[model samples]
Target: MSKLLEINNLCVDYVSPNGIARAVNNVSISIAEGETLGIAGESGCGKSTLAFAISRLHKAPALISEGEILYKGQDVLKMNDKALREFRWNEVSVVFQSAMNSLNPVITIGEQLTDVMLAHKKVTPKQAYEKAAELLQTVGIHPDRLSAFPHQLSGGMRQRVVIAVALALEPKLIIMDEPTTALDVVVEREILNELYDLKAKFGFSILFISHDLSLMGEIADRIGVMYAGNMIELGEAKTVFSEPQHPYTQGLISSFPTIHGPKERLYGIPGNPVNLLQIPQGCNFQARCSHCFEPCTEHEPVLKTIAPEHHVSCHLV
Candidate 1:
């Protein structure tokens, strides 16, 4: 398939009180049409920051220091405010965490959805309302409930409403950050199933971000493991799960419970993620990585192809 999005050497920085903090440091990844790519990492590992940079959502404190986020062969970093405003929801959309809160409390669900359509589609409010009703039905919600308030909907229902809003413009790619983290396991599974079905039907790509490796393994076509703003590993989902080359990735997998098995103990990665302002001299994960060698503490490893479509950034790999 043809590539739809390509992020090249993307680095996002922040001017904190102490010093410069590299939130996303020299990361790159791409997505083909209709593909699903999962980005897995702990909080502060730069996963969400990357999303912000890609969508041009970074603010004053958080800035894209260097890199180009290309979508559909156009340089996203170079887009003007007018272009960006149009590019945002029309081509690429984001369904943020706890997206239930994205709805305006004062406005009815119908009005909120209509607002998005009216802005992007340049349609009349009446036309926008009809479109919103269609979108609610598409996401398995009742069109009659369009007049309900945001607080009136259940958490799962609210999430579906967000998903429905995300599809209002039928974006080619959707960046979903912890989309199901706030829901129960059963509800989470149902939402994921619905997403899978929608992906199959719409042929839209997704940049799925989460710390839940196990859950991501179920929905992603490929997986990229990040550690302290660096992409430590990338490969086919089965290959990554079966034989993780990066020690950090292996450690992350060990931290998750397996399905269809007795309750085996899960181990957490030791030590906390490195602070970007005071980043270590070598591999950022070297301190917490049990398989680390002396060389790991002195030199940062560059990404190397370990197999067909698999890349790892570990000296020991």
Candidate 2:
């Protein structure tokens, strides 16, 4: 697979009156054509910040302090305004956590979908509307509901509509930030299955962001675990789940219940996640790690290759 996107040593910071908070610190990752890469971490771990930075959508106090986001060998950060406008939606689309917030409440679903097409593509009103209806149907919604407002639909339906809008321009890459977090388990499953089918049909890569490691194991070709704004472990989905190298990755896996395993009490990682505003010295997870040692407290570990396409950042490794 050819590399579709490459993010190298990307650092994102939130500059405020008080101080700067490092949200994404020297994170590097890549997505290949038609592949799905899952980023698993707790909230405030900078998963969403990385996604926003890739699309150049970070605003206000959020600043890209360092690194390069290369999409098809083109630097996204250096793109001119006209190029940036064309890059979004046409090349990459984002499905945010909340579908309600992503959509316009007053606009009909059909209109919203058509609006995206109209804004980016050269199409007639009739053609755009027809495409909108087709997109709704493609996502398992009835075309009739295209005329309904966002509030008129169920949570799952609204999410599907959001996905339909993301697929409006047939983007090469889709960044889904907890796209199914708001739906029930059953609805979430259905949506994920449909999303897999859509990806297969469209041949587009996906950067799936979620706190659910189990869900990531199901759909991701590879997984990267983040903690306190740093990537601690990255490997194939199966390897990461079966043989997690970092203590944080192991803790995250043990916290979830498994269907095949014997019944056991779920264990949560001890200690709270590190504060981004004032991160402690050495390993960010050393405070919570039972395996912490003198080196873990004194020296931060860089990512070391454990195997081809597998890496872990830990002194123990």
Candidate 3:
């Protein structure tokens, strides 16, 4: 497979009155063309930070401290303002968390979709309207609803609209930052099913971020597990689900329940996520890991390939 996006030792920091928080620490990963890569971790594990950094959308106190973000061999971290404006949406688009609520309540859905196409100069006003209606239909929404306000649409419909807008310019890559966080399981499943269908139809790659392991396993071609801003495991979804090498990955796998397997008690990983402001030395997950050893407390581990296309960061591994 060809590489679409490559992140190398990416680091992001948040500055505050108290101190600087290392939100993303030397994280490296990639998504192949026409592939789906899922990032899974707890709330404060920097998954969202990484997503924002990839799109060059980190703002305010958040700053990119180090590393390279390359999209299709072009350096993303060094793009000029004009270039970035052209790069975004045309090359890559983002479906933010709770994107359903991001719609302008006062604007008509058609206007919002048309605005994106117009902003990118991808189509004329008349063509934009035609494309907008077509996009709504593509997401399973009635074309007539383009004239409706956001408040008039249901949550699921609004989410589909957000996705429609992201697809208006036909970006090659879509970064979905927990796109279904606000929807119910049934609705989430429906959205994902449609998303998969759309991906097949458009051939765009996806970078899906979420805290749900089971969901990631269901949709992602590969899965990367993050903890305290560090990527602890990277492998095929099935391999990681069945034979996690990192202790943290194993603990995370144990926390989620399986659908067809025998019912078992949920076993949560002990200890909270490490504080980014004062991260411990050596392994970031050492405090919570059951297989921690002397080396785990003294030396940080680098990712090493354990099996074919499977990598792990841990002394024990």
Q: Compare the candidates by TM-score and give the number of the best one.
A: 2
Q: Which has the better TM-score: candidate 1, or candidate 2?
A: 2
What tens digits encode model 2's per-residue C-alpha lDDT throughout 77-174?
99999999888969999997785567889999999999999999999999999999989998999999988999899989999999999999999999
Runs of candidate 3 with Cα error greater than 4 angstroms are none
At residue 272, what lDDT does model 1 achieve? 90
TM-score of each: 0.97, 0.98, 0.98
Residue 14 lDDT in candidate 2: 97
Ranking by lDDT: 2, 3, 1
Better of 1 and 2 by lDDT: 2
Candidate 2's TM-score: 0.98
Winning model by lDDT? 2
Give lDDT tens digits, candidate 1, residues 191-223. Answer: 899898888888899999999999988899999
Give the residue spans of candidate 1 off by over 4 A.
Answer: 261-263
Count of clashing pairs, candidate 1: 0
Q: List the residue pairs that clash in candidate 3.
A: none
Q: Can you rank all candidates by TM-score, best first? A: 2, 3, 1
